[model samples]
Target chain A: MGARERIWTAALIVIGDEILSGRTQDRNIAQIASWLNVQGIRLREVRVVADDSDAIGEAVNALRARNDYLFTTGGIGPTHDDITVDAIAMALGVGVEVHPAARAMLAGYYETRGGLTEARLRMARVPAGADLIENRMSGAPGIRLGNIFIMAGVPHITAGMLEALTGTLEGGAPLLSAQIGCWVAESEIADLLSEAERSHDGCQIGSYPFFREGRVGANFVVRSTSQAGLDACMADLKAALEKAGWPTIAGGI
Target chain B: MGARERIWTAALIVIGDEILSGRTQDRNIAQIASWLNVQGIRLREVRVVADDSDAIGEAVNALRARNDYLFTTGGIGPTHDDITVDAIAMALGVGVEVHPAARAMLAGYYETRGGLTEARLRMARVPAGADLIENRMSGAPGIRLGNIFIMAGVPHITAGMLEALTGTLEGGAPLLSAQIGCWVAESEIADLLSEAERSHDGCQIGSYPFFREGRVGANFVVRSTSQAGLDACMADLKAALEKAGWPTIAGGI
Candidate 1:
C-alpha cells in the first residue's frame, strides 16, 4: 500500500426533543453524511440528543473535541425550545451574541411578510466569534464557530445550507464505491467477501442482506478512497460471486 | 402536582458502516423510539457509530453506564463485519460463548435451507451471561445482558424483536401527548407555547415549523407523563392560538 493520505473526519449532533419523542423522523443524519462524503470528509459518528441544554452542551463539547469538524442540526428555530445556540455557546465557554449580518438578512426576508419580532430575531444569535452560514430557504441562517456548523432542523433548509457550504471546507479524496447485488444469502459467500476485502488494501466491503421477492439476496458495497482500489475490489467480488453460481447485478438491485 | 415518579430512560447505540456512510437511511431510531415510549420508557439519547469494534465497545460502555436500559442495533449478522457481540462482551468484561438455545434455534431454522454453516453459527454467540430475545421473524435471536438489549440492524427484524420483548421491561407511566397545528408562523406563538409549558408543571411543548402549500405553519406537540397534564397543556396552547386569531387543527395538519 502507498503512503496513507490524511483522512478528514466529522461528527454530527442532531438536537431535538421531537426526534427523541419519535414525533419527527430525523432526515439530517443521512443528508449530512452524504454531503460530507461528497466533500471528502468521512462522517465518523452521530448523536441524537434532546433539546435540553445540558444534553446539547455535552454532545457539542465531546464530539467537537474529537473530530476535525462537527455539524449540528435542529433547535435553531424561532421558538423558546430552540436552545442549540445557547447550549453550544455555553459548551464553548463563549457568550451568545446576535450577528449583525444574520440580523440584516432576517430583517430583509421578513420585511414584506412581517417585521422581525423578538422571536424571529432569536434566530440571529450565535456563539461569540462565530460566523453566519447563509440559508436561502428562510429568514433564519445557520451558524458556524471554529469547527462546529449549526444547521436547521428542517431538511430542506438544511439542504440549502449544505449547498452553500459545498467545497468550502478542507477535505481528503472523496471515497468511491461500487455495488454488486446477488440473489444469495450473505452467509453463503461470507468467506469470499472477507477474502476479497483482505486482499484489497485500503478497501472495505459492506454486505447488506435483504429478503426480497420471496428470495434471499445481498448487496455488497465496495468502498475506497482510491478509485482504482474500489474498481479492483468490485471486479474481484463480482467475479467471485459469479464463479460461485450467484449471478451478480452491477450497481446493486 | 403529585409526587414525581421515577423516570426510566434508555440510550441506543446504532452500529453499522452502512448508516455512517449514508448508504442506508436509519429507520430503527423512530421505530425503537416509538416502541420505547409505548412501553413507558424514554429514549434519552442515541449514538450512531461505525462497524469498528473499538467504536462499538466505547459507545456501549459509556451509554450503558448512565442509562437504566441501553439498546444496540446492527452488527449481529453472520459476516466478517458482524462483531457487535465481541465488542459488547469486551465492554462488559465478559467472554463470548455460543448459547445452546440460540444454536439449536439456528440449526432448526437452517435445517432445510442449507443447514447452519460455520458462518451462520456466528449468530449464536453472545456475552457470557446473556439471554435470548426471540426473533419471531428470523432465526438469529436478539441478546439481553443485564440492561443491554442487542438486536438486529434490519428494521423489520428489529421490529419483530421489539414486539417479542414488549411489556417485558420495567418503566414509568407511559408519556401522553397531543398535537395542535396552526397555520401561523411558530415565532408568533413562541411565547404562548413557552408559557403554556411553564403553567403546566409536568408538561413539555415542542414546536416544529414547516412550509407547506405556500404558507408557513407549525405543529405544537405537548407531552407529559400524566394524561391530565398533557390535556390541560394542549387545551391552553390551542386556546391561546385561537385567541391570537390563528385557528388550530386538533391532530396537526
Candidate 2:
C-alpha cells in the first residue's frame, strides 16, 4: 500500500420518518454505495434516522467527523416533514438562508409550470457559506456545505445530482471484485475461504449463503484494490472448492 | 402519560459486507422497523456495519448503550464471514460456547437431510450466558443476550425470529396513524399542516409528496398514541385542505 492508494471512506445518513416508520423502503443507501464504489470510495457506515431535527443533526455531526465525506438523502423536499436543511444547518452552527442562485433556478423552473409559492420557495434554503450541487432533474439544487453533500430523497433526482458530481471528489483505486458460486454449503468450506483470504495479501472474501430449489449454496465474492490480486484470489478459491469436490460456477446461480 | 405508557425504543444494526459492497439490498431494516412498531416499540435508529468483527462489536456496544433494546441481523451463519456471534460475545465481555439446546436442535434438523457436519455444528455457538429464540423456519436459533437480539440475515428466518419474540417484551401503546391525500402540492399547504399539527396535542404529522398522473400531490400522515387525537388531527387537516379547495382522499394515491 502506497500513499497514493490510501483508502477513502464515506458515510451516509438517510433522513426521513417514512423510512423509519416502514412506510417507505429506502433505495438510496445501495445506490449511493454503488456510486461511491465507482468513485473509488468505500461507503463505510450508514445511519437511518427519523425526520426529527436533533436526530438528524446528531447523525450529521457524528458521521461527518469520522468519514472523508458525508452524504444525506431525503427530507429535502417541499413538504412540512422536509427539515434536513434546518437540521444540517444547526449541526454546522450556521444560519439557514435562501441561496440567491438556488432561488433563481427554482423561479425559472416553476415560471412555466406554476408560480413558486411560499412553500415551494423553501427549497432554496441552505446553510450560510454553502455551495449548490446542480440538480437537473428538479430545479431545487442540492446543498454542499464543507464535507457534507445533501441530495434529494427521490432516486432519479439523486442520480442526476450524482451525475453532476462525477469525478469531482478525490479518491483512491477503485475496488475490484470477482464472484464464484458453488452448490456446497458455505460452512463446509469456511476454513478454505479464510485460508485463501489470509494467504492473499490485500484481498478479502465474503461468503453469502442462499437456499434455493431445495439446495443450499453460497456465492463467494473476492475483493481487492488491485485487479491482479483479485484475479489470483478468485482463481485460488475456485481451485480449492473444486479440489474439495464442489464444482464452481463463474457467475452466481 | 402514565408510567406504564412509557415509550420503548430499539436500535438495529445490520451486519454484512455484502450490503456494504452493494452486492445485497437490505430488506431487514424495514421489516424490523415495521415489526417493532407492531410490538409497540419505536425503532429509533439503524446502523449498517460490515462483516468485520471489530465493526460489529463497536456498533453493538454503541447502540445497546443508548437504546432500551438492540437487534442485529446477519453474520450469524456457519461460514467464516459470519462472525456476528463472536463480535457480540466480545461486546458483552462473554466467551463463546456451544449451547446444548442449539446443538440438539441442529442435530435433529440435519439428521433427516444430511448428518450434521462439523460446519453445521458451528451454528450451536452463542454467547456464554444467552438463551435461544426458536426459529421455526431454520434450525439455527436466534440468540438473545441481555438487551440484544441476534437474528439470521435471511428475511424469512428473521421474520420467524421476530414472530417468536412478539408480545414478549413490555412496551407502550402502539402508535396509530391516519392518512389523507390531496392532489395539491404539499408546499401549498405546508402552513396548514403545521398549524393543524401545532394545534393538536400529542400528535405529529408527516407529509410525503409524490408526482403521479402528471400532477403533484402529497399524503399527510397523522400519528399519535391516542386514536382520538389522531382522528381529530386527521379531520382538521382534511377540513383545512378542503377549505383551500383541495379534496381529500381517504388513503394515499
Candidate 3:
C-alpha cells in the first residue's frame, strides 16, 4: 500500500490439527511461498494453527489485519475437526450457511456417492457476505471474506485455489539482486556499505558471510528498485573497497 | 514437562526485516519442521516478526511462555538493522553488554585487517543471564537466555547451532510413521475418518490428499504409542473401509 507499489501480499495460516500434533511436515508454506514469490506478490508470514476454533479465528483476524491478503490452508474439510469455515465466519462477524454456488459445487462431487446427507452438506457452508473461491480439483470450494481467502488443507485443493486467485493479485515491482563474494567480513567494507545503502535509498543491502578456498569472506548483495541505482551502488561500493586496501579483482595489486 | 517419555521440544521464531517486508521466501520453517519431526520433538508454533524492538520482544515473551525450548534464527549480525539482541534482552528484562564468551569467540577473527571495531563488537553483546551457543564457522556465537537459543539467520550457522544443541536435547521416544494411499477425496472420507479418529485415541491420524498413479487419493497415516497398537488400528481401518464398500486395499497392497 506504499507508493506505486500495491504491495500485494498474502500470509499463510495453516489450520490443520495434523501439523501441531507433529503428524505432518507441512509442504504448503514453502511451495506457496516459492510460487507467489515468483509472481511478485510476497507471501509474508505463515502461522500453523490447530483445529481449535479460538486459535483459528485469532490467527485469521491477526494476519488479515497485517497483510494485503491472507490465505488460510487447511481445516476446511468435511470431517468434524475441520472447523475453519466456522472460525473464518466468526472472525469476520458473519453468519455462515450453505450458499447456492457452494452447495452446487458440493452436490456435483457428492451426487455419485449415495450418502449426500446434512453432514456432507456442511462443507457447503460459507460466510453470509463472501465470494466463492473456485475449486478445480475437488468440489468443496473455498470462500473469500475481505482479505482472507480460506482454502482446503489438502495439497491439491490448496494448489488449485492458488491458481484460481492468481489473476486477482497485484504486487510491487520485483527487486533485482546481484551477489559478489570477497575475502572480507561485513566490517571490512563498512563505509562502502553505508554509501551503498545511503546512495540507493530504494535498495536493500545484505552481507552474507562465507568461507571458501581456505578463506573467510562475505558476499555483499545489493538489491534495488532500479537497475541504474544498483549499478551506482555497486560502483561506489567497489571504489570504497579498493580505497580501503582490499584489492579489487580487476585493479591489479 | 510432559509424560515419562523423554520430551523433544523446539520453538522457532523467524527474525528478519526482509520477512516483514515480504522480500524473501522463508525456507527455515519447513526445513526445521522436517528436521524436528524426524527427531520426535515437536517444532511448535512459529512467530515471524520484523526487526522492530517491540514486535520481537512481544513475540519472544509469548513464545517463551508456551514452549519448553526456543530457537531463533536471524538478527544475530553486525549491522544497524540487526536489533535482535537488544530486543531479546528487552523481552527477558535483561541488559546486554560485551559478553566475555562472545568476545573470546571473536578474538583473532580479524587482526591486521582494519575491520572488527567497536561497532562490530556489537555482535559480541549478549543478554546478561545467557550462555554462548557455538558458531563453528563464523565467530558470532548465538546467545542462550534460559530455554531460548538464539541463532544466526544464515542457514549454515542455524544448522550448526541446531546440531550442537541436539546432544543436549531431551527427546520423546522417536516417532515412527507408516503411510498408505487410498483413492478418495478428503471430502469423500469424512464420516469414516471420524470413526477412524475416534477408534485411535492413542495415535495421531493424518490424511493427506494427493494425486497418485493418476488417481486422486488420500494417504492415510496412523501413528500410535506402540507398533502393536499401530498394527491393530491399521487392521481395523482396512476392515472398516471394506465393510463400508470403499476402495479397500490389503495391508501390503
Candidate 4:
C-alpha cells in the first residue's frame, strides 16, 4: 500500500471469563483503541471471549488473519485459568515452554519475598519462539509472537506494556478529532452534519445525543487522518449549526 | 442437545466509530452480558466494529448464524451516522421502511416538543417484518428481527430495552457464582485452586489477582449452572485456602 493510501489496522481479543460473566467491566478495549490511534494504527475490531482455549485460539487465528496486528488481554497470570499463552501456542501449532529470560526475571522478582514456586514459574511460560514485551509494573513480561502482542488483563500493567511499545510499531498517519456540542436535538441538524461530511473528503462525523438538565442535546465528533480535512469538516459543521439557529460549544456538553 | 445440558449462547455487535475511535467507552458489553446471564443465556462472544454498513452486516450475519441470538448496540439514533437499522436490513435481505406504529409513536412524542421533521422521523425506520421493542424512557423503540435485537448505544436506554425483554426469550438454568478472596499471591495457591476445580464436577473457578495496600491478593470466582454445585465448590475452595494458611474473605476484596 502507498504511504498516503495505507491505513494500518489492529484487532483485539479480550480473553477473560470475568468480562464475559459480567463480573468485571472491561477497561482495556478503550485504552487499547486510543493507544493504537495515537500510534497511527486504527483499532478495527475487538472480540471478547471466555477463558476457553478453543474460543481464544479461534479469535486469535481469525483476527490475526484480517488485521495488520492482533492483541490479546487477560489470561496471562499465574493461575490455571491464565491460559492465553497456552491457547495462542495451540493456535500457532507449537508447544509452550518456559522462556529462560522470563524464568530468570520471575526468579529474581520473587527471590526477595519467596522462592519461585511451580505456580509462580507458570508466568514464565510462553509460546515457542516468542519474544518478551517488558512489563515495568510487574515482573512477569508480556509476550510478542509475530504480529500478536499478549498483554496483561490488569489495566495498569497493560498500560505499562503499551508505554514500553511506543514508537516501535509501523503505523500510518495519526487520526485527528474535533468535537462540537449543541443544545438542539440532533434530529434538527442531522442534514447539516451529513452535508458537511459529504463536502469534506476523508472525514467522518459521529453524533452522540444526551438528555441532561431537563433538555436534550448532542455532541458531534469529526475525525480525519488529515489535519486539514478534519479542520475543514469541523469549521463547516460549526458554521452550518450556527446558521440553523443552534448555538455550538467547542468542547462537548 | 440435551434439555439440561444445552447452553444457549448469544453474540453482540457494537457498531460505531466513536467506540472504535476511543471517544466513547462502552458500557453495553458488560450490561448485556450480565443481562444475558440472568436470563440463563451465555454471551459467547462480542465484536466491536465501525459504523460502516459492510462491517455491521457481515458481523450480524456471521454471529447470528453461529449463536442462538444476536444483539447490536449503537448507530440507531436519528442522525445520519445511525445506520445500524439500514445495515441490518440489508443483512437480512430486506428493504428498509418506516413502521407505521413507530412513526405514530414518534409523531406523538414530537408533537408536543416540536413536529417530527424528516430527520426525527428517521428513527421510525426498520427492516421489513421487524417488530418494535418497547422503549418506555424514549419514544423511539428498539428493533427486533428474527434473533437479532438492535438496541440504543446509550447505556440507560439500552438498560430500559433489556428490562422490557426480561424473561421473554427462552433460556436454560441461570448460572450461579460465589466468590472467595484471600490476601495471598495467587501463584502460591494456584495448584490448590486448579485441583479444586478439577475435583468439582461442574464448577469452573476463575482467579483474579490484585495488589493493594502493598500486598498481593486474589479473588476466586466459582460458577456452575447448579446452585448446589456452586456452593459446594466455593466451600471446598475456601476450606482448601484456609488449610493452606491463607485466610479467605467470604466476598471479594
Q: Which structure among the candidates has the greatest DockQ?
A: 1
* lDDT digits (tens) for residues B169-222 of candidate 2: 977888777788889877778899999999999899998877778788788889
Give the DockQ of candidate 2.
Answer: 0.73
Model 3 docking category: acceptable
Q: Assess the local accuracy of residue B251 in candidate 4 as a C-alpha lDDT between 0 and 100.
A: 84
Candidate 4: list runs displaced more than 4 Å: none
Off by over 4 Å in 3: A1-10, A17-44, A109-122, A153-159, A167-187, A210-231, A238-253, B1-10, B17-25, B34-41, B79-81, B108-120, B167-177, B223-231, B242-253
Please tell me which model should have the higher DockQ, number 3 or number 4. 4
Clashes of each: 0, 0, 3, 0
Give TM-scores for every candidate, taking all chains together and pairing residue i with residue i: 0.98, 0.96, 0.81, 0.98
TM-score of 4: 0.98
What lDDT does model 1 reach? Answer: 0.93
Question: Judged by lDDT against the true structure, how good is candidate 2?
Answer: 0.89
lDDT assessment of candidate 4: 0.92
DockQ of 4: 0.84
Model 1 per-residue lDDT tens digits across residues B73-191: 99999989899999999988899999999999999999999999999999999999899999988889999999999999999999999999998999988988888899989988788
Q: Could you give candidate 1's per-residue lDDT for residues A88-143 as a string of tens digits?
A: 99988999999999999999998997799999999989999999998999989999
What are the per-residue Cα lDDT tens digits for candidate 3 across B1-253?
A: 4674655666688887555444455567666665676666777677777666887887888778777777788888876567889999988888988888788667656455454686578889988978888878777888888888888887777888777776576667655556665666655666776787688766666666666677666767776656776777777777776676666644322
Q: Candidate 3 versus the native: TM-score? A: 0.81
- Model 3 chain B: lowest-lDDT 10 consecutive positions: B17-26
iRMS (Å) per candidate: 0.6, 1.2, 4.0, 0.8
